[model samples]
Target: MLKQNLSPDLTPLRHAHRLATLYSYEILDTQRESVFDDITRMASTICRTPIASITLIDAERQWFKSEIGLGKSQTPISASICAHVVLENDVLVIADTSADRRFGGNPLYTGDPDLKFYAGAPITTADGVTLGTMCVLDTVSRSLTQEQIDMLRMLARQVMMHLELRRMLRLSEKTSDYRARMLASAAHDLRQPLFVASLSVQSLLQEAAPHQLKRLTLANGGLETIKKGFNRMLIAASGHASFTLAELDDTDLGDVLEFIHANFLPLAERKDIRLSVLRTRLHVHSDAVQLETLIGNLVANAVKYTEAGGRVVVGCRRHADHVALHIIDTGIGMASESVNTLFEAFRQGDAQSEGLGLGLWIAKRTAEALGVSVQIHSVPGRGTHFILSLPLKASTEPSSEPIVQVR
Candidate 1:
């Protein structure tokens, strides 16, 4: 009597193509589903086998997508019987493992569950790539009838259809999420500034004096409020327009601090609060425009919350490979619980304060785009400090470095 060879040769190129097709489905390592479980259960019952599995051939293993009567989730590809079925791209049936020299020595045939009979139909894609097998296993030697074999192939096709459906559902979910985020960003950004402008107008109507000149002075404050609100709206719009890394560059930390001082000094003065900058000669890797917006928001927030005669200080602390730009203020600080939610858009620490609570949120988003880290420390009734740690940019020219305090 002559022995028959049943193992199919799996070439490297063919295996690579099969793996690529499997990955495109993105179904590997996903949680168990009743759909797949039902299919495997049906396969076991229809074939009169003790075990059935929908096995996927991964890079280094054969992972069971669904299994009945199997405790393990996966097995090594080297020891996998389905690995051979996938290579054949057709149904493989072994009536008796002990009689087949190819599987008689396989551990699965000799070990627990002691599989002596096996049949598998390859789960093939429409493009003809065989990703894995839908198979039945039995502890005793047996042969499947022609009808049973045909049924197994049909079940394999059903498995492929389910995988395709799952892929389509995942893509649809992602598209919906993207659209929702876009709508939320646009609505929030536009509404924030308009809300602030309305508040400013209301304040002007109530605070204006009888004398023309005094009314003009009162109107100046309201106009400033409108201007600041528009600035915030513009920044938010730009952030959402098309966020990318192309806006990044080597920016001077000192120059940004100076700009903040120039812009916010009058607002600080009108409130009878002290504002100062402790300048440094540090240059950091960041987007200059976005970095300025981030620092400006922090400073403005500090000024808004601080009481008359309180102080807001902007400075830098040097580190070995990075520098931390600190905005410290003597203000009505926040509770520890509130600190966590400070960066959430439209969340205000003090509902009584004027403006939409997007300042810190915008700052946080800008810092992320620049790959910088922002940290906060606050004590109720004492102060709040925002620290932005930035990577130090390399420079060719070395110059005198000094920390100069300016009021």
Candidate 2:
């Protein structure tokens, strides 16, 4: 009879437990054959047995996973001695099966070549669940030396290792598939806003008045925002490609702030907010592109969270051996908790906003790469102040320049 009815009280759980273990491997019918077959072949040759198999015990049969010298594919559990070895959950040795009580009356011993010798070791997982067995059989009543039995068990451990590798490979493929889908979805959602903004700007420029030109300028700002967001996503995807820093140049902080104010003033005006550049002509030696992106991200963040009619002030001060630039804004500033984890990649502490949560992280990393220091102080209800300190050129003396709002 097929051994389908698992006993509720004692040995019955073994059938169900083995079935569960077999399913967990996720390796049935997989075509990428590994070196697991070599173990079975080696085991057969070393033991000098004509038949050997790596059998996975199922609910009603013994599945021949990796077989050597076996013409039959699988065997019914009722006729499989390997199935009995799995049920016992230990190494089973019947030196002379024909002389034993359990095998003397069995058909596999009494009818088929009069089977007389058996040695099987349980293939158990790390958690002590016996999945199946690696066994050798012969028709003559014979005994295997102790060393042969130990080597057979070692080969069983190799089968367990093969199953574990297949499980990890499947998991890694799944994670990579999920990330690809996420990037594809994010690209689709962001394209709509960019297309609308570009279309609006094209229509406005045809018969634009001076005041409407300002409106067009503000609308064009959305295109830049979308582009910056996409660039940040690309940077994340191209993970940690190192950038080579060139020698710093003599760059004026005032010129950089003036350029930003000129570019963003119309956008701020459209929302009834005011933007001011309070200092000009403060010079330093640094990478201009890095400085531009770092400042742009900070200013963009300020504009995004601030309410209409609020003010954003950009200024710089001449410190002893460095120049300090500040961007202060009356915006919906972050809480203490958000500030604590602000520089961590993909970790957005504020749940109410929609973003990739990579701006501040990229900004901080860029600043560190350029040997600049950035600090922030904020309260949830009040506002935020971001301070950037850049080292000064040692040989050049400070130039006297007026503090004015320049276009």
Candidate 3:
């Protein structure tokens, strides 16, 4: 087997041609299964070879995805006899390794599990670049019957079909996962508005008294809460819906925080908790829709976990290259285990919280995509704080815009 380094510069056209050929197989680092294994086993039996391998040659190594009677999955490309087999246009056979000068003292023959005989067929895509070799090995020097050689070629064709089918199946699974997420988000959004309207109507039917008026006020507040929940769900679903970046604007961070304050205050008041914003003069280049969703989830979570009469604060600090906004709450903070998975999709620290378990996950992903970063700090019995950091300067030209603060 000749040892030639396949460098890109050595033959640019040839390298591109080979890549195209390998791509046609659509087999890269894919999962293994019984279907392909069965074919290898059958091929080995028919050929009467003690050891057989289905090997794919990568940049640095000859990789066996499935092998019978072999423990190692890889060997350096320089040492592979199959490397020579791939360069050939047809079946490569060594009638007897001991008799042939090319392989008589081959290291593989002198080392453990000695190789005395070799036979292989090239696994070439339709474009004609050999991606790898389908081979059988023997410990005793011997020649294969012509019928056996033909069977090996037929099995290689079946391997190519198996690779193609697996790729299509994986693509289908991804599409199905995407559709299911959309449906779940829709259900989460619709349940809120519908629940609020029902509750408002029921409150109206109660007797007109002091307690009744309080109930009415609480019900109206619940309607507002539902409105905000609907908005955030839309934000999260939109992020999942697209691959391209969305339109951004010079958004007022102060105004965004103020709006979230208005929505969360009533919930905080219901529990007799204090909610206040300590910073108001900051500006950021961001998507207004996603920025709103990010802050809203943090504030809501603070209120949800805090006990009665606890304090929750939202503030922003100015740094050299970035602005950091934090929502700190004296609440029932999560344990380390829960916090680790806090931003994972469909994970919940408290199953009782009003969410589809995607708020923090969406917020984390949306902030990152918009060139912002988020941090979380918490103590189990004390509280939790969410810090959002955004670059002071946009990736584009510096703007002369001033930071605005609303008291």
The local lDDT score (0 to 100) that residue 210 gets in candidate 2 is: 81
Q: Which residue pairs show collisions in model 3?
A: 280-405
Backbone clashes, each candidate: 0, 1, 1
Per residue, candidate 2 scores C-alpha lDDT tens digits across 1-407 of 22232222224535566568778887554432325456677678878887777887777767777776666667766667776677677788888875666554566677755667888888888778877888887778787887678767867875664465344334423443323223323443464355446645755666699878887877678676776675455334323333356677888777777778887888788877788877666678787866876787788777767789898888877777887778888887788878887775434434444554455655776686567899999888677888899878676467554333222
> Which of 1 and 3 is the better model by lDDT?
1
| Predicted structure 1, TM vs. truth | 0.43
lDDT of 2: 0.67
RMSD of each: 21.5, 23.4, 20.3
Q: Which candidate leads in lDDT? A: 1
Error of 2 at 203 (Å): 21
- Summing lDDT over every window of 10 consecutive residues in candidate 1, give the lowest-scoring window: 176-185
Output candidate 1 Cα RMSD: 21.5
Number of the candidate with higher lDDT, 2 or 3: 2
Residue 96: error of model 2 in Å? 60
Better of 1 and 2 by lDDT: 1
* lDDT of each residue in 23-100, candidate 3, tens digit only: 555555543445556667767887898888888876566788678877777886656777776665478888666666
Alpha-carbon shift of residue 162 in model 3 (angstroms): 34
> What are the Cα lDDT values of the candidates?
0.74, 0.67, 0.67
Off by over 4 Å in 2: 1-241, 347-352, 399-407
Error of 3 at 311 (Å): 0.9
Clashes of 2: 1
